[model samples]
Target chain A: MAEVNRQILLVSRPQGAASTDNFKLVETPLAPLADGEVRVRNHYLSLDPYMRGRMNDTKSYAAPQPLNEVMIGGTAGEVVESKNAAFKAGDKVVGMFGWQEFGTSDGKGLQKVDDTHVPLSAYLGPVGMPGATGWYGLNRIIAPKAGETVVVSAASGAVGSVVGQLAKLAGARAVGIAGGAEKCRYVVETLGFDACVDYKAGNLYQDLKAATPTGVDGCFENVGGDGLDATLARMNAFGRIAVCGYIAGYDGVPVPLKHPSLILTQRLLVQGFIITEHLDVWPVALKELGTLVAQKKLHYRESIAHGLENAPEAFLGMLKGRNFGKQLVKLI
Target chain B: MAEVNRQILLVSRPQGAASTDNFKLVETPLAPLADGEVRVRNHYLSLDPYMRGRMNDTKSYAAPQPLNEVMIGGTAGEVVESKNAAFKAGDKVVGMFGWQEFGTSDGKGLQKVDDTHVPLSAYLGPVGMPGATGWYGLNRIIAPKAGETVVVSAASGAVGSVVGQLAKLAGARAVGIAGGAEKCRYVVETLGFDACVDYKAGNLYQDLKAATPTGVDGCFENVGGDGLDATLARMNAFGRIAVCGYIAGYDGVPVPLKHPSLILTQRLLVQGFIITEHLDVWPVALKELGTLVAQKKLHYRESIAHGLENAPEAFLGMLKGRNFGKQLVKLI
Candidate 1:
């Protein structure tokens, strides 16, 4: 292993939209493994939309990501050195290792996983935080009944892709709202959703209405602009909405719901959730996700950025919908 | 008791704001009571804000109020004549009798209420639909715990008065937002709310922020406008908002929530409900409401209009915040 650790830090807060200038990359000496500490060599750094919210100094589900710190993130890696009794060398693990090539933990929050069947990087997407996020939003919040219709925005992204597939698995009709025709095809053909609406087609409301013939009974909202507005218009009475993210409003603009009266008219139950606040569900979510991956029932794609230096651009691209699937930085 | 029934009919739909012109007075020949039917002489006609929503031909929780028919409403009256064994003459009951001097029911929806301890009109306010509405939204949706702050809009209105008192009874801090100083005084002094903010004071956000120092944990929203928007700004993390009505938007204006991001940032559960959809809670809700009114633990106020021909203006006044507490028309 190397003595030098390459890491990225949040240097400044974004004014409107995030850019690479807001982040800085530096090389520092890796900390030695102290007593009861384990050294992890991070392989993949997960770039999610929630990070954009943390970049602003606003009150949110989480505190603002402090400046001049290793950017907060999820990582999947192998234990290079261990001083804790619970962990051993060469153990594949996952934790909030942040945006760094090396991390030191006391094995407290680190979760050891079996990478024999599921790949190590897969834990950062399908069987990890994003996976658990999708699971909790769909299963715990929406709770789709059989034959019900579930519509998910950002349907090709990590969390939403899983929501659509899981909705189908629950015997509910799964419809997706994606940005492009290419992503829409992948959502329906690869992800096995019942139908897909390409929001970029400039016919969101009409297309969404046509896609959901019966009406949307449950919604997994990832983006909160026209896609969500259109979905709200087509919602059935007593529909449930799990607001996992508002990627459209992360640019520091106050995004308003156009039809606030619809909530009462439709009798909708709209709930917003942050996955980090619900750690109690990980064991249940991970077990099912891992089993599905091993059985080839769950599939996830990733857009890989090669170096730690490119993490800032990768993050900005993810926020602007330029990156497809789970955006990950390869720090190895 | 009478050969003809004097009634008000919805002759036209409102274009923007509901006016007296939409209603017409007509005396119709009463259909003689058939077998298994009961004739009710309506003593009190309950005028609520929800009637404004039904005046428009829009998709809502309940269907539109059909034109050229008696305006839909709740009524408390005496059973004048009965052909059903389940009901008898001189019995005090409550049901959806619409806006008229008399009503005939098949005894299916009629509720036999004991007005010995609770007054007949109190059944329309406290031990009735509005009472049950406050009960369900508070006990079922918000579910405020001890020491939590519960804020309600339209605080001096029928449903809001009960919610504030109920919040205090549940050991929570009750904060209210009313339109003027008089209603604000009644909310804190009569209804026993912890604090009442007069939205007309020109400092809604600042005043509400002062009233809820610890931040609002639960909100019972009746009118959607600046009051709700101000409450959203002061909401604590994991706050619960039970939306019962949007009187501000009933004028056919689209009301947009200024900060929809707050729902996600605060991790709130904002649900809109119609009490009619939840019949399961009526028994439990009415039991508590009835006992409270009977024991004089629950206090209510009403502004009664004299005749059924004036029901349209009474309704328009209630929608504009002219009437205090329950807006009931004395049809006796």
Candidate 2:
């Protein structure tokens, strides 16, 4: 058994953009588990854009991540040791284990997950928080009807990929906006989106217009820069926009929407939502998401960075649109 | 009846700010009414800010006011001669007679009303489209619960006055944003809004923040610029914003929403609506509004100019915040 545990701690808050200097890697002896506590060997650490928001002490739906604490994150792993009757050795679990090699929990938020059909890493992507985030935003907010056109920004990322697929499952026309040609191709070919716009191709407005010949009816907005501005311009009358993430504005400045007058002219409905605030939906969401994964119908890709020490780089890369899919770090 | 019918026509579209040069006052020979037509000598003309958007040849929910034609406007008058059996000669009626001294209608869209209790011009302001505008946005979109704070921009104007009054009736704390001290006073003292922030005071953000101690739960946005930007900063979680009008962006430019990231952090629902698009609700909305006005429960004010030739000036002044309430022109 591993006698020592390694963890990444946020040493300081970010001034503008976060860097590895803001975090410190530390080694600590694994404390003996208290009564009714279970120890987990975290296999994969989920690196998401939301973590960048947590790095700053700004007003947000979720509380700010404190300094000198293990960086907040989602993890999927196997139970290595247990002092609780509910958990046993080798049982797969999904929990907020954060950026660490091991976690000790009283089994409060820990959920026992099965990996008989779906892979263990997938619990961190599909059938997990990201999957549920996509489901709630698409289903509850956007509510795309059959034959309507739905556009998703950051289409290659964890949440957006699921949104496009589910939008397709709802029989709506799914379109995607990604940063590159390769990711855009993958989005259309593999995810079965009707069209994909490469935003980095230098003509986002024209490309998106060309891609969505019919104006966008529903939009899952993950990137909020020129992509959102262009989407606002092309939206049909009475369109719906689900504001999920704004990776472009996560640093010190809040990105301004360039054309807000479209909200009046087009009569659009723009709603912002936080997935964590809606905990009541998880049972139904996870049931559907978990079933799709078990049946091998849900398609997903991963960009895995080996070693816990490389998590910061992978997360920072995902913010820059460098990672192709779900960004994660493999600890084992 | 007058042999010559004088009318104001939109001769040319505005380049930037509209002026008297954009309209041409001409006297035309009154056309003879057809068998099914009714001729009405208009007494009042409603000059609204929406005319500015139509003058600029810009994108909007309504089509641009056509050039070289009688300018579009709502009017109230008594039917002077009736060829249609449904109308009598002295019956008071309301119709879109534009900026003209006389109108001939087939009675398709004309509505006869009883003015024994409510004034004739009240149909153009409170018991008319403007009143219904306030009703739909406040009731359907904002839907504020008791004790929730609702802020309305341009609170002294035609639509805004009604919005604040309706919100107060719904048991929400109504805060208004008006242009000057006098309008702010009227918004609070007469319209019964809980508070009014004078935007010309140069301390909008601070004053609004002080006024809404519990934060704003709903916003009825009429003028979109710094006022809207400030309101966005103060919105609470799950706030609802009904985007009714952006009078600030009416001429050749669209206003951008600064700090749009607040939409995500606050989890707001921002929807834009055109009152003209909602014809079905007018029946019920006007009934409630008319009863309130007739019973003197709803107070209203107006800025009236006395000639059709002066409508261009009145409209421009209303757009500049010179008018205190519903801007109108008395044709008689």
Candidate 3:
């Protein structure tokens, strides 16, 4: 076992866009586990867009990640040692273990994960929070009927990829909005989406309109700003928009929704959701996601940043749409 | 009976703000009623903000009102000449009779209104579409719990007044937003809202934050733009917003929602609804509204224009927030 634990802490609140300067790497002497505590050696630290909001000292769905503290995030790891009855050594588990090489928990929020049929990293992407988020937004909020056109922004990302795949599985036409041609191609050819609009290609509105000839019936919005506006413009009457994330505006600057009056005229249902608040659907979501992953039906991609020291740069890159898919840091 | 019917026709679509120039008053020969048709001498023509949208040559929840035709509107009238079995002479009925003194219908889409305890014009305000709209939004969309703060915009207007009253009846604290001090007073003192924030008072965000110390749990949004932004700023996590109308943007100009990231961080459910699409709730809504109006539990105010010739000006006035409460043109 390592004598020291390396952790990344938020040194300062981001004014607009977060950079590596906001984070600090610290190596602290490992302390012995207390009673009912399990020490986990984190294999992968998940870096998500929602983490950016946590860096701000403001009221949000979750409490702001404390300054000069370990930045909160999801981690998939193995139990290296345990003083808790719920967990045994070598047990694979996932929890909000944060940006660290080691995490000690009281076994309350930790969930045991099996990597027999699915890879361990799959729990951090397709069969985890991202998957459940997509499932809940697409199923509960959007609820697109068969033959409807469903548009998903950040199409190559963890959540959006699952959303498009699920929409296609439900017999709806899935149209994805991705940053580059390569990602767009993967979204269409690999993920089996009906169409993938490269937002970087310009003509966003016209491209979206061309993709959704029947008008958009549902939208899984990960990117807000222009992508959301384009989708709103093409939304059919009684359309639904499941706003999973607003990554475009997470950097302190406000993103305004253009032509909000269209919401009234179109009679749209736009719901914003946090997956953590909806744990009831997680069981159903994870089961389906696991089955898809096991059967090699669900496709997922990850851009890994080796070593815990690289996490800050990887997170910043992910925010800038630099990462291709799920951004993760390899700690072990 | 009058040989000629005086009607307001939409001569041209307004570029920005609707004015009297867009409407042309015309006298047309009354066509003879056919089988099952009933001729109604409209007593009151309801002038609503939605009429402004119908005047534009664009798609909306309902079809655009045809150019050079009787301007589309709801009317409460007496069936002076009924050729159908469902109605009789002097029978008070309500239907989409448009901006005219007399209307001929096949008795379809027309309902006989009782003025025993509730006034006939009450069917155009409290016991009508506006009332139902408020009820549907408050009960279904916002669904505020007891002790929760529910903020309502355009609080003295047709739909908003009813929404605040309903929220109070549901045991929720109702904070209202209105144009002027007088309207704000009516929203609180008359309509029984807990507090009223006058948007025209110029301290919208601060006033709203002060009024809703516990933070807004639900919002019945009638006026959008700045009013929406203010309410949104004070919203609690998991807040619900029932967007019934954006009267603030009814003049063809776009109303953008500021700080849309709040929707994601707060996990708000912002749904826009055209009351017409929710006819399933009308019977339930009307029954409750009728009982409330009959018992004087629900209070309402109406700004009445004298004749059908003045309908255009009244509508334009209503759009500009010149009239308080339900705007109606007394055609009789």
Best-fitting candidate, scored by DockQ: 1
Off by over 4 Å in 2: none
For model 2 chain A, the run of ten residues with the poorest summed lDDT:
A252-261
TM-score of each: 0.98, 0.98, 0.98
TM-score for chain A of every candidate model?
0.98, 0.98, 0.99
Query: Per-residue lDDT for A225-307 in model 3, tens only?
Result: 99999999999989999988898888777889988888888988888899988999999999999999999899999999999
TM-score of chain B of each: 0.99, 0.98, 0.98
TM-score of chain B of 3: 0.98
DockQ of 3: 0.84
- The Cα error of candidate 1 at residue B213, in Å, is 0.2
In model 1, the runs with Cα more than 4 Å from the true position are none
Please report the candidate that would top TM-score against the real structure. 1
**DockQ for all models:** 0.89, 0.85, 0.84
Best candidate per lDDT, number?
1
- Candidate 3's displacement at residue B159, Å, is 1.5
Residue pairs whose backbone atoms clash in candidate 2: none
Candidate 1, position A286, lDDT: 90
The CAPRI-style docking tier of model 1 reads high
